[model samples]
Target: MTQTHPSPAADTGPGQWNPRLWGLLLVLAGNMLIDALEVSVAVVALPSIATDLSLPLTDVQWVMTGFAVGFGALLLFGARMVSLLGRRRVYLAALLGFAAASVLSAFAQEPGLLIATRLVKGFCAALTAPTGLAIISTAFPQGRARSRAVSVYTLFGAGGFTAGLLLSGWLTEHTWRLALAFPAPIVLLLFALGLRLIPNENSTTAGTPPTGHRSYDIAGALTFTLALLTLVYGITALPEHGLGHPLAAGPLAAAVLLLGLFTLIERTVSHPLVSLRPLRSGALVRSALGAACLNGSYLGMLFVLTYQMQTVAGWSPLKTALALVPAAAPPAIAALASGRLVARFGAPRLIAAGAACAFTGYLLQLRPSWPLDYPGRLLPTLLLVGAGFVLSFAALNMQATSQLPPAERGAGSGLYQTAVQLAAVVAVALVAALLAGAEHAAGPAAATSAGRPALTLVAVLGGLGLLTALTALARPTTPTPSVPRT
Candidate 1:
C-alpha cells in the first residue's frame, strides 16, 4: 500500500482552535469515555450480580469476559465497516445500539440474557472505539495538536474505568442493575451530539485500495472470534473443572484448531482483516504488547482487590471505591501533561517507566499477610499503579497509530484496541480462575489466600511489559531511506 501524508492545511496548529473542532473532539472523547467505562463499571457489581443470580465465580465473570470477547472479536470487522459505511454513520449507529443494549442489560433477569446484552454493548463499543480514533487521526494534524487531542481522548478512557468503579460502588449498593443501565442515557446524549459532529466522509482516504480489492473476510472473523471465545471459556473453566474434564479440554482443543485456521485464513485473504505488514513494525508491536500487559494487569489487579476489600476486609462498596481512587485518579491528571511529555522524552522511555512503576506496585501487594494493612501497604500500591497508567496510557495510544498511513489508521486502531480487549479477557479469566480455585480450597478465608497468586500473576505481566518497553528503548532507530528525484 502507498503511504499518504496529511496535507499541510490539516495541521490548523494550536493557534487555530475553533469551537467546531473542539466540539468534534469533545464528542469523540466523550464517546471514548463511555466505551472505556463499560469495561469496568460492571466490575464492582460482579459480586452482587453473582449473588443475586446464584452464580459461581467462573460464570459471573462472563459478565466481564462476554463484553471483551465481543469487542475484541469484531474490532477488525468494525474497522472494515468504518471504511465501507463512513465513520459518521457507524459511530451514530453504534451509539444508538449501545444505548439499547445498556437498557436491555439493566432489565435482564436471566444470566444468559444479561451476558448477551453485555456482548451487544461490547460489539457497539468495538465499532465506536476505533471509529472515534480514526476520525481524530484524519481530522487533526500529525503534530502537537493531534498528540494533545489523542492524549485528552485517551485520558478519558483511562479515567472512565475509574469513574465506572466509583459509579458502580455507589449504584451497586442499591442495585447492580442501575450500574448496568446508567450508561444508556449518557450514550443516548452522545449519539445525538455525534449525529451533528462526526464527519460524513468515509474513513477510507488516499492510501485506501479500490473497492475491488476489499473483501469482508467473514470466515476469518468468525474463526478468530470463536477461537478467542473458546480460549477464554477453557481458561475460565480450567480451575474448577481441571484439564481432564470435557468442559476444559474440549474448548481448549477447539481454540487451538480455530486459531490455526484463522491464521491460515488471514494469510490467504486478499484484503486481510489485519494487514500483516504493520505487525513487522517493532514500535507497533511493542505498543500493542505493552498496552495489553498494562491493561490486563491493571484490570486483573482491580478484580482481585475488589474481592479482597469487599469480602475479606468487610468494606462497603462506596468505601472500597474511595480507597481505590488512587489507582485511577492519578492517571487522569497525569494524562493531561503526557502529550508534552511524549514530545519531549519520547514514548518508549515513558512506557518503560510506567511498566516499572506498575510492576513495583503489584510486587508490593504480592505477599499480603493476613489482616492486610490498608493505608501503609495497599494505598501505596494503588498510587504506584495509577502513576504507571499516568506515564504509559497516552504514550501507548499515540505510538500505536503514529506510523500508520491515513487509510490504515482505522485498522491500526482496531488492532491496538483488540490487543487491549484480548488482554482483559485473558487476564480477568485467569485471575478469576485462580481466585475461584483458591477460594474453593480455602473456604472462609478465600480472599486472603486467593489474592496472593492473582497479584503475583499481575506483577509478572507488568514485568513482561516492562521488558518489552525496555527492549523498544534499547533498540537502535533506523532512518527511512530517502527517495531520489524521479
Candidate 2:
C-alpha cells in the first residue's frame, strides 16, 4: 500500500521565517528543559532538602526518583492526551500544573510530601514533553526545517542539563527552594508567551484524528505506573540494602510480576500505553539499546568524573560541572546537521560512527591510576568523551525518530525517553554500588588508586553499547513506509 503522506498543513511557511516558528521551537524545547531542570536543579538542592527534612541521602534521592518514575509512567499517555485535549491545550495545562507542582516542591515541609509533589510534577512533564517534539514535526515538516527544529529542540535539552547544573549550583548556594521555584516563574512567563505564540491548530502531527473523543485508558495508565514504581523502588533500594534484603527483593519481585501483568494487559487493551510492536523494528530496537548504553556510560562517567575532580583533584562543584561542558556539545551541532548527514551518509552508519567515537573516548579515559593523575590522564579522556558524545546524540535521535510513523511518534518517543531515563537511573545505582563497594574495600586512598576499575566498568558498558550500534550498519539506507506509530 502506498501510504499517502499528509501534505503540509494550511499554515505551512517558506522563506517567511515567522517568529512563531521559532516560538514554536521554544515551546517544545522549554517543555523538555523543565524535565531536565527537575533533575539538575534537585541535585544541587539535595543537601538542602535533606538538611531541611532531616532525611538520609538515600531517602532524599527519592525526591528525584519519585519525579522520574512518575514522568516515565505517564509519558506514553502524553501522546494520547495531545490527541484528546489538543496539543496546545495539553501543553498549556502542563505548564500550569508544572508551575503549581514546583511551588509545592519548594514549600513542602515533609520529605514524603515533597516526594508526592514530585510525583505530580513528573506527571505534568509526561503531559508536556511528547508534544514538544510532535509540535516540531508539524511546525517544520521532516526536511531542512525539521532538521533545524530538532537541533534547537535537542539543544534545549542538552543546554538545559548544562543550565540546570550551573543554575543548581548557584541557586542551591543561596536557597534550594529557589532552584525549584525558578522555573515556575519562567514557565508562567512562557505560559503567557505560549498562549500568544503557539499555533491555534490541535493536530501538531498532521494526518491523525481531527479532534474526536479519544478514550483515556485509566486502567492501563494506573497499572503501568504501579509496575514501574514498584520496579524502580525495588531496583533502587537494592544498592543500599543488598538484593537479598527484604527492602529489595519484595518490591523487585512485585514489580516484575506487576510489569509482566501490565504487558499481558497491553496486548489485550485498546489504545495500550505501549505496544510491543516497536520492539520488533530492528532499527529502533538497536537504536534504543545502543542509546541506553550511551546514556548509562555517560551518566556513569559524570559520576566518576565528579568524584575524581571534587574529592581527589580539589576541583569545586562548579568546576566539576563546567568540566562536563564538552560532553554536551555534539548533540547540539549534529541535530542541526542531521538532515544533511542522513541525506548523504545515511542514519545507520552515522549512528555506528557516533558510537565508535564515544567508545574510543571511553577507552582513552580509562586510566589505571587515579584522580591525582589529573591533566595527564583525566583531561584528555574527558575531552574525547565530550567530543564523541557531541558527534552522536542528535543523529541518533534523528535516526530513531525518522524510522517511526507519525501517529506512533508519541508512544515511540515515550519509550525512547523511558529507556533513556531508566538507563540513567540504573547507571546511578549500579555504578554507585560498585564504586562504593570497591572504595570500602580499598580504603580511603582508593579514591586516588583504584578508581580505574570504576572507569573501566563505564568503558565496558560503552563498548557493549557500541556493538549494538553496529546493528544499524546492517539496516538498509532507506526505510519501508512507516506504519502509524507504536
Candidate 3:
C-alpha cells in the first residue's frame, strides 16, 4: 500500500513549535475543557434541580442523559459534516450554538425545555469535541510534538470535570441556573478567538478542493441516532419497569433492529458516515473499547457517589464536591507527565496498569459500611480512580488517532468520542436502574444497599477494561519486514 504524507504546513519539524501553533492548541483545548465540563457540572447540581423542578431523581438524571444522547447520537454525522463543511465553519458554528444553548438552559422553566437545551448543547459539543481533536491531530507533527500536544489537550479535558464539580458546588449554592449558564460567556470568548486562530481546511490540505459531489449518508445518520436514543431510553426504564413492560421492551427491540439496519446502510452507502476501513485497526479498536470502559465506569461510579454523599450522608453539595476532589484532581496533574510515561512504558502498558488501578479502587468501594469513611475508604478509591485516568486517558486518545490516516482522523475521533459518550449513557442508565430497583424493593432506608449494586457494577466495568488492555498488551508485535536492495 502506498503511503500519503501530510502537507508541509501540517507537519512541523522537530523543535519547530511556533507561537501561533501554541495559541491554536490552547483554543482547541479550552473548547475541549468546556465540553467535558458540561458533562459533570450538572451532576452536583442535580439534587438542586430536582428539588427546584419538583421532579423525581430518575427524571432529573435526564439532564445528564440528554446531553450524552445528543452528543453520542450525532457524532458520526458531525464527523461527516467536518468533511463536508470546513472544520473552521463547523467549529465556530458549534461554539455559537453551545453558547446559545447554555443561555437557554439558564432560563428554562419546564423540565422538557431544560432537557431540550441540554440536548442541543450536547449536539454542539459533538461537533466541536471531535473537530478540535481532528485539528490537533493534523496541526501537530507526528511523534513527540503530537504526543505532548495530545497530553495538554487531554489534560484540560481531564481537569474540566474536577473544575466543573468545584464550580457547580459554589454556583449551585447561589443558584442552579448559574451552573447551567456559566459556560456561555466562556464559549463565546472561545468563538471570538477561534475565528482568528483556526485555519481553513482548504489552505492546509495542499490546495485540494473541497469534495462537494460526495453525498451525505442521511439514512445511516438517522438509523444510528434513533438506535442510540432508543437504547438509552430502554436501559433507563429497565429497573423501573420490568423487561416485560412496553416502555422497556419496545425500545430495546427497536434499537437492535435499527442497529442492524444501520450496519446494512453503512455497507451499501457510497459515502458512508463511518467508513469501516479505520475500524479495522487493532490499536483504534482497543483504544475505543478501553476508553468506553474507563468513561462508563467512572461516570457511573460518580452518579452513585454523588447521591450517596448527598442523600444518605446529608452532606451539602459543596462538601460532597470537596470530598470527591481526590478523584478529579490527580488526573490533571498526572496527565502533565503522561506523554513521558507513554514514551517510556508504552500506551498498552499504561492502559493495562491504569485499568488495574481503577479496578482495585472500585473493588475497595464495594459493599461499604454505613458511616461513610472518607479518608480510609473513599479517599483511597478516589485517588486510585484519578490515577487510572492520569495514566490512561491521554494514551487512549493518542492511540486511537495516531494510527489512522490523516483523512480519517476526524471520523476516528468522532468514533472514539462516540464510544465514550454512549458508554456513559448506558452505564449511567444501568446504575440508575439498579439504584431505583434497590430503592423500590427495600425503600429509602436501604440506600446503602442500593449503592452496593451500583458500586459492584462499576467494579465489573473496570475489570472488563483491565482485561481488554491486558489482551492488547499480550498481543505479539509484528516486526516490519526490511526491503531488499535492488
- TM-scores for all predictions: 0.88, 0.83, 0.89
The best candidate by lDDT is 3
lDDT at residue 435 of model 1 (Cα atoms):
85
TM-score of 2: 0.83
Q: Model 2, range 146-179, lDDT digits (tens) per residue?
A: 7667666766776676677788767766777887
TM-score of candidate 3 on Cα atoms, chains taken together:
0.89
| RMSD to native, candidate 3 | 5.6
Cα lDDT, all candidates? 0.81, 0.68, 0.83
lDDT of 3 by residue, 4-28 (tens): 3233335456746777678788889
Candidate closer to the true structure by TM-score (higher is better), 2 or 3: 3
lDDT of 1 by residue, 152-258 (tens): 78778768888988998999889989999998998888777766666555332323423655577889989988998889889988888899999999999999999
